[model samples]
Target: MNRHISPDGYRVDGPAGQDDETGADLPAIVGRNLRRLRTRQGHSLDRLAKLSGVSRAMLGQIETGKSAPTISLLWKVATALGVPFASLLTVEKQAGTVVLRRDRSKVLASSEGRFTSRALFPFDSERQVEFYELRVAPFHREDAHAHAPGTRENLIVAKGAIEILVGQHAPVELTEGDAILFEADVPHGYRNSSHGEAVLYLVMTYVETVG
Candidate 1:
């Protein structure tokens, strides 16, 4: 399977669970997550260095699991990826009947790593409602694909500021403790242009009840 690596920071690896990151494989987990996020965003080590403000050499070392970064350094990289610092630390796991902690949740990132989305619901293919939390870095915009017919999305700003744009309408600006709901069948997006990070809890609901 594609770990999404290129010449700048590429590596092919086994699929999740085959050789996925676990609690014991912290460094490898971080490296794998970083590589996947970087490649999906089309970032080479050089480009990631520019984005994360970390040296390319260090970025390479992190990818190869040869180096462990300080918490501050990890923050820089997480900010660059528009994801929470905990995301890089999360371990890959199979979906379970119960998830006891957010820190242990599985994470998915934007193509550019400008946004990190944590799944809050069980990985049920038939589930109609999907819940998630999103972390976005300053000045980052995330485009979301349209969902099923009659689908709707609801969001609450847990922290910072954001602008939600649905279809051709003007963007709606929100601050801490604000909320919005809109049809998700059409195109939509979230934008965070402030100097501070934005945190949002999102709920996506489809028309039909999933079984």
Candidate 2:
């Protein structure tokens, strides 16, 4: 299979040449959502670039479906647009019971692919809480920027050992079955301390729904 690395350094991997479950191109979906939201808020590319700290060229590329955005970049744009992170990924809602199969999960990885996050909930509607599965390569660390105000995260270590660092607070270590809850409005990071990959589950709750 051929793989292409995004400008932000993460690679996109999925069934070759296949669309996502929504039967639409993933990049196109993101692009449409971005363009719609940006125009809706009466913000031009230059204005969005200033607010998001992302270059206008890159923003234009994303809006035109010419480039796939990285997780960090998406977060920056979402924050700037005052919308939920999932808002950029959402498609038409599917009614009734929904089952998210593992093979079909939407996964986002870090630049080096040492860290990954898989969304466990459908991205069809605005939600106050979101669930995700996270994996960190052995001895790898993933740093995340601050989220919107009033955000909170509850995470539990599922396998192996790792350390959680939240802002200036001392690092908190966790083993299998250990969990921690903390405000997520500040910078935070995860460090895997074991020789084997570490697995974790995260529940992120927002203070209010946006977009």
Candidate 3:
């Protein structure tokens, strides 16, 4: 953990990662990835829409680059796909140098630009876990759908305050230097309850598929 983060201090907001070798736009990249993954899994728009809790129209929009999905929506899609959350957000391989870099990492942001997650490692079939630097804007909440069974999420608060709610349990509060780990197989979210942005290190573990 070299802590490679956004260069712009705290307000790192954007959509679906950085430019790969191709320099494609965020919508195009996400749409292409989503379409490929859905078809590979042999899921149709109607079926995937029902499974993901997103409307078939919206799914069609996302698959056609006509819309940009929020973090929550993307999470739903990934969960339905039985893959890591970054599967649809990632369009290109991260350039390697043994250590991660801000430029090399793929950063995915909410459609509203309130939440951003920067992937700290390259995704591959052999990897069972994914790590990220998460940034949440003031008063923003990113609600994520449940992951595949046996998935867990670990969060370490680096700055500001956050309220985390997993499943239907009570919301847990965390401040600077505090960490919380919980089963991510249920619905979960991160909320910035304070006026400042909440920065955290998030680790996602998957079993048999991604842990």
Candidate 4:
């Protein structure tokens, strides 16, 4: 294995800065799930690589949380494992499509404080829709992140402000109560321009199931 170290703020062992019972543990939870699925299918690292066309080294890295897999790679693994790509993602359950209370949410924060995510669905939900509350502190910016082929990210501003930059489109600014929905295939990033903190809600979908 390459034995790559966890990025400064990111946790390679699991979701960073989250505890076992606090819902902050998505990375770990997801990692375990992947391991379980792999074991259940009687596939080894080499077998997964041959089946998914992903390198065994890469699979080891993903399974160990030493790296973040690109959306395409994730899909390949999911396909080989015979599971929905969304099944590998971590999300908390919501009461409905309207709101997600803080108390019932799981917060995923990077150790470096770059970003924080609160799940809107149970971490193990099989639903097609996934909701996340994202917080980007001042001076914190995100690299382009994308999901499965048909995924869409609905960004709604609940507090503070942020600039949503998607692929080649001009950046869009969202403030409190403002929201934007777009295809998540192309690269995207979030920038917090406020002097203090900025928060937003991101609802990601594997298909166009939610309008």
Candidates ranked by lDDT, best first?
A: 2, 3, 1, 4
Encode model 3's per-residue lDDT on 1-211: one tens digit a residue: 1122222222223334344432565566779889988998899999999998999999998889877666667768887888777676564464545465576555666535688888777543225688889999998998777787888989999999999999889999999999999998988889999999999999989775542
Error at 92, model 3, angstroms: 4.0
Pairs that clash in candidate 2: none
Candidate 2 regions exceeding 4 Å error are: 1-4, 16-19
Order of candidate numbers by TM-score, starting with the best: 2, 3, 4, 1
Per-model TM-score, in order, reads: 0.55, 0.93, 0.73, 0.65
Kindly give the number of clashing pairs for every candidate.
2, 0, 4, 7
Among these predicted structures, which one has the highest lDDT? 2
C-alpha root-mean-square deviation, each candidate: 11.8, 1.8, 6.1, 6.5
Error of 2 at 63 (Å): 0.7
Please list the C-alpha lDDT of all candidates, in the order they appear.
0.69, 0.86, 0.75, 0.66
Q: 39-97 in candidate 4: lDDT tens per residue?
A: 97799989989988889887887777665654446657765775655566644554555
The numbered model that scores best in TM-score is: 2
Indicate the residue-level lDDT of 72 in model 3: 64
TM-score: model 4 vs. ground truth: 0.65
After aligning candidate 2 to the native by TM-score, how far in Å is the CA of 152 from where it should be?
A: 1.1
| Pairs of residues at least 3 apart in sequence or in different chains that clash in candidate 1 | 5-10, 6-10
